[model samples]
Target: MRDNYREELDDIRGCLVDMANSVGSQLSKATTALLDADVTLADLVIAADDQLDATRESIEQRCFTLLARQAPVATELRTVITAMRIASDFERMGDLAEHVAKVARMRFPDSAVPQEVRPVFLEAGHVAESLVTKAGTVIAKQDVEAALELEEDDDAMDRLHRQLFREVLSEDWPHGVETAIDITLLGRYYERFADHAVSVARRVVYLVTGEHRINAAG
Candidate 1:
């Protein structure tokens, strides 16, 4: 019986890792399209999001099966609940990637962001990607410390988001109102992605330590 429970836990972890990889690839491709103005890559990001949706459903179904069949307790129950929570976060991340791809497709010949702001976008994307990847590691390794560190990494994305808005809204910036809106929206997408990643990390910390971390209340 113990061995059977262990097997189920392993299955849950495997499914989660697969889901994380799918969402991470979506984020990476979306970032590439935004940075290079690659319409093809944007299209690919849009198409790939469907796979993540399917993966989420598959994981959710497996979790439900385990709950019904095994009747998990304590840590096992927590693991299954965490799996569900993380899957939802990954799905939301995929949606945010699609939003970015939409912005890329919106401006065909020109990129949504100005050349000057490209670096900021790239940095935010990197931070957001790092957050997701790190959350995956925490899940696999059950590393509470690494999960805690995600909050600090999220700060960089927040700073860059603010910097992007400040520059776009500056009177001297020359791209006009339309350009400002695009960049503002793009920055927001990246920021929100990072925010969701942080949310996942907090759940990981809770699962490991059994104490909820401090975060903004809904």
Candidate 2:
């Protein structure tokens, strides 16, 4: 029974890693859909969100069951609890990707991103993807160092987000209010996606070290 419980815990950890990879893939496709104005691809990303939701539910149920049955303590308890929180972070990441896809669909055939700031969105996509990929590694290995590095990666996303605001708010900006709003929303989606990825990494760090890293605002 002890061996079986250990296997169950490992399985849950593996599921979290799989969920992280799925979120990364969704972001990649959403970025392509946004940049190219491909409604079909955008629709695919939007529709696939249901599967991510199901995965989150499955992870949560498994964690709850482990908690009720095995009564995990110390690091094992932290692992189970952190898995639930990380699952939630991954689900939110999926929603953010879906939001990006919806914007592409709304603007259909005309890229939501204008020519002047297309590069910013493109770079934001890259940073978001990189952060999630590293997050998966942190989950699988429980590497606190790699998890800490995600904080720096999140800073890159923050910089890109700020750059986007400057471009839209500049006096000489050409895009009108409607386009500016779309740009603002899209930048925020990417920025928040990176934030959640970092959040997942931080949870993993906590699971490994029992130390919580406070945000600047805290």
How much is 147 displaced in model 2, in angstroms? Answer: 0.7
Candidate that scores best on TM-score:
2
lDDT tens readout by residue for model 2, 18-38: 999999999999999999999
**TM-scores for all predictions:** 0.95, 0.97
lDDT tens readout by residue for model 1, 118-171: 888888888888888888888788888888888888888888988998888787
What is the C-alpha local distance difference test score of each model?
0.84, 0.91
Model 1: ten consecutive residues of lowest lDDT: 209-218
Q: lDDT, candidate 2, residue 41?
A: 94
Off by over 4 Å in 1: 214-218
Q: List runs of model 2 lying over 4 Å from the truth.
A: 214-218
Extract clashing residue pairs from model 2: none
